[model samples]
Target: MINRRIMMTSLAAGLIAPAFRSAFAQEWKAKYPELIFAIIPEENASGTVERYTPFCAYLSREIGTKVTLRVVQDYAALIEGQKSEQIHVGWYGPASYARAYLTGAKITPFVIEVSSGGIKGYYSVFYVKKDSPYQSVADLKGKNLGLVDPNSTSGNNVPRFVLDKMGIDPDKYFNKVVYTGSHENAVLAVQQGTVDVAANWWNSDDDSNLTRMAKKGMVNKDDFRIIYKSDIIVNSPIAYLDSLPEDLKAKIKQAFLEAATKDKDAYAKLSDGKDDPFQPVDHSAYEPVVNLVKFIDGLRKKNG
Candidate 1:
C-alpha cells in the first residue's frame, strides 16, 4: 500500500506542475495587451479620434496584441506620458521627436511619405493671400503672422529658425503672432484674412494641402500664394519605450516594416495615403533636428 501511494503522489505532482508553468507563461505573454499608444491632437477632437482609431486596430492586429490610442492635449503631455511610461509608442514630429529622444524616449522607425520625388522630407511654406501685398519673407516684417504650434516642426520651429537666420526676430518682426494649434487652422486663418501670413507643412508641388482644403470647400486653389519654403524637414517618427524587451522590440519592428509593404490598405489608412508604413530608423538620423532645437534654444535665451 505504501509503494502504491508513493507512485500516485509522484504522478499527481507531474500533472499539476506543468499546468502551473503553462499558466505563468500565458500571463507573461498577455502583458503586451496593456500597452497604450499616444498621439498628438492636431485637429478637432472628434476628427482626430476618427482618423487614428483605425490605425490602433491595425497595429493591434499586426502586433498580435491589444493596443489603445489616446490623444493628449499637447506635445508636452505626450512627452510626459513617455517619461511616466504610460505611453508605449508615439508618432512624433521631428522637433517633438528630438525633445522626447533627448529626454530618453527611443526612436525606432520613421514614416516615409510618398510624394512627387518618392520617399522624401517636407518643407515649411509660409503663405499669404494671392492678392496680399506680402511678396517675400521680408515683407512680413512687423506684420501679423499665424503659426500653428510652438512645438510644431514645420509650423513654428522651421519658420522661426528661418527668420532668425535672416536676422529677423519673430517677436519683434511680427506685429502679432498667433498659435492656431494646427496646420489647417493656420491655413484657414490666412485664407480668411484673420492673419496676414501663415506657416504650414507642404510638399513641393504636392496636392495634399490643396486637396484637403478643396474637399472641405474651405479655400480655393487660386486664393493663396507661397512666399517662402524652408529646407526639408524629416517626417515624423515612431518611438518606443526604451526599456521594452529586446525580443519584443524586434518583433514590433518586423511587424511595422512588413505591414508597410504587405498591407497596402492598412498603410494608406494610417498615413492618409500620403506615405508608406514605416522604415527602420535610429537616433543618428535625427541629428539635424537636435541641432535645430539647440539653435532655437540659444536664440530664445539671447532674446530673453
Candidate 2:
C-alpha cells in the first residue's frame, strides 16, 4: 500500500508541474499581442503623435508585431507607465531617464540620439530678445523668467545646475517665475516680451527651437539672443522596460537602430529634420544628469 501511494504522489506532482510553469510564463510574458510604445510629451501631444506615427508603423513591421505610439501626459506619466509595465518602450529626455532610474522604474535605455552635426549632446540655452538690455544671466536680476517643466533636461535641470554653480539662485534672483510647460512656449514668452529671459535647448547648426521657428516664420534667429548655455548635456534616450521578454527586447532594439538610416523621411520627422541617428547608449551616459538632479534637489531644499 505504501509503495502504491508513493507512485501516485509522484505521478500527480509531474502532472501539476507543467501547468504551474505555463501559468508562470503567462504572468511574466507580454499580455497583449501589440506592444505599447510611449513617448513622454517633450512638446505638445498632437505634434508628438504626428512625428512618431511613421516610426511606430515601421517598428511594427520590423518586429513582426504591431506597435502603438502613445503620447503620455508628461514625463511623470511615462515614468509611472514604465513602473507599472504598461509602457513596453519609451523615448525619454535625459533628466527624465535619470529620474526613472532613481525612482526604481524598470526601464533601461539602449539608444541615444546624435544630431546632424554629429553633436552628441545639446545645451540649455538661456535666451532673451535681441533688443533686451540683459547682457548676461547677472543682468536678468529682478526680471521675470520663463522655464519649461522641471523634468526638462535642457529647459530646467541644466539651467538650474548651471545657475547654482554660478552662485545665482533663480528663485530669489528673478522677480517672477513662469513655468511655460514647453520649450516652444518658453521661447515664445521671451519673444513676446512676457519674460526677460527663458531657457530652451540648443545644438549648434541643428534644427533646434529657433531654427525650426524660423522655417515656420514664427521667430527669427536674429530676434533672439542666447545669453547663457549649459555644458553639453547628453542627448535624449530610447529605452525599454526590463519586464519585457529578452527576445522581444532584442528585436525592438535592433529595429530602432536601423529605423533612422532605413527611412530618412520618417526619421527626419522624428528628429525635427536634423537626420540624427539613434546610437547605442548605456545607463552610464546619464550619470551626470543623475548628479545634476541631486544637485538641483539640494538647491530646492536650501531655498525652501
Candidate 3:
C-alpha cells in the first residue's frame, strides 16, 4: 500500500475550516475511500515524504477523503503510474507532465505553483562558490559542471536548452558534467566545491534551492553565487488523472485552490516563497516545455 503517514511539521491552525468540504464529498466515500496523490521523486524519497506530507494532509481534509501521499522512484514511475491510473493526483514536474500528457496519459493539469511575488515560474541558475572566479557560463569552460537529473526541467532540460542557445554543447563545453541527482545535492556540491559550478532552480524574484537549504539551516545563501540564470521556466504543476470522475477532479482542484489561498505560507513552501497562492492552468501552459523536450531529444539522437 502507498504510505499515507508522511512526517512534517504542523501547519498554521484554523486556516482551513472543516465546514468548507463540499457536501457531495461523502457521495463517493464508499467507492473511493482513499485517493493516491503521488510526487515525482525530484528529491530523495525521504525528503519528498517529509515535505509533502502536510501538503497531502491539507488536500485530504479539504477534499474530505483520505489522500495517500506516495513518492515514486523516478519520473518514469510517476508517468507510468498516472498512465496506468495507479496514481490519482500528481505533483509533477513540468517536462514530465508534458511528456505524460502527450503520450496519452489521462492526466490534466489544473493548478500551478505560484511564487511569493505572484510569479508562476522560476529560473534555471548556474552557481559557484562565492569565492570562485567564474563570472559567466563561458567562464566555466574546461571546469566541472553539475546538473540535477535528466528529467529535471530547471536542472537539465532548460539548462541544456540555454547552453545550446548560447552555442555551447554541454557534452563538450565543460570539462566534466555530472548529474548530481537532486537540486539540493547540486547546490551542496557547489557549496562543498566538488563541482566548479552547478545548475539548479531559483525563484525568479525570490529564493531558490540555496535559500530553501538555508531555511532548513543546512547551508547559508552567502556561501554560493549564481553566475548564470535561464529565462523563466514554469514552476512544476499539479495534475490529476483525467480518468477520475469529473466531479472528483473538480473537487480536488477546488480543494487545492482553497487550501493554497487560505494557507498561503504553506503554498509558498512549494516554491521557496517565490510564489503567492496558486493559479489554474492547462496543458497549453506547458507547450514550450514539450517543445524543449523535443529539442533535447533531438540533441540526444544527434549525439548518438
Candidate 2 TM-score versus the reference: 0.87
Tens digit of per-residue lDDT, candidate 1, span 175-250: 9999988877888898877889998887755454654565558678678889998987887777788777665666
268-302 in candidate 2: lDDT tens per residue? 88767775677889999899889988888888888
lDDT of 1 at 217: 80
* Candidate 1 residue-wise lDDT at 161: 95
TM for candidate 1 is: 0.85
Model 1, global lDDT: 0.76
Model 3 agreement with the true structure over 1-304: per-residue lDDT tens digits: 2232222212222334343344445556766799999886545677667777777778788777899998777677888998998888888778888778767898889998877657788888888988888899878889899998777888888888889889989889888999887788898888777889998888743467777678778788887888988888888899988777777888898988787676666555555545566688998889999999989989989875
- By TM-score rank, best first, the candidates go 2, 3, 1
Residue 33 local lDDT, model 3:
91
Badly placed stretches (over 4 Å) of model 1 are 1-28, 106-117
**TM-score of every model?**
0.85, 0.87, 0.85
Show the colliding residue pairs in model 2.
none
Report the Cα RMSD per candidate: 6.0, 6.3, 11.2
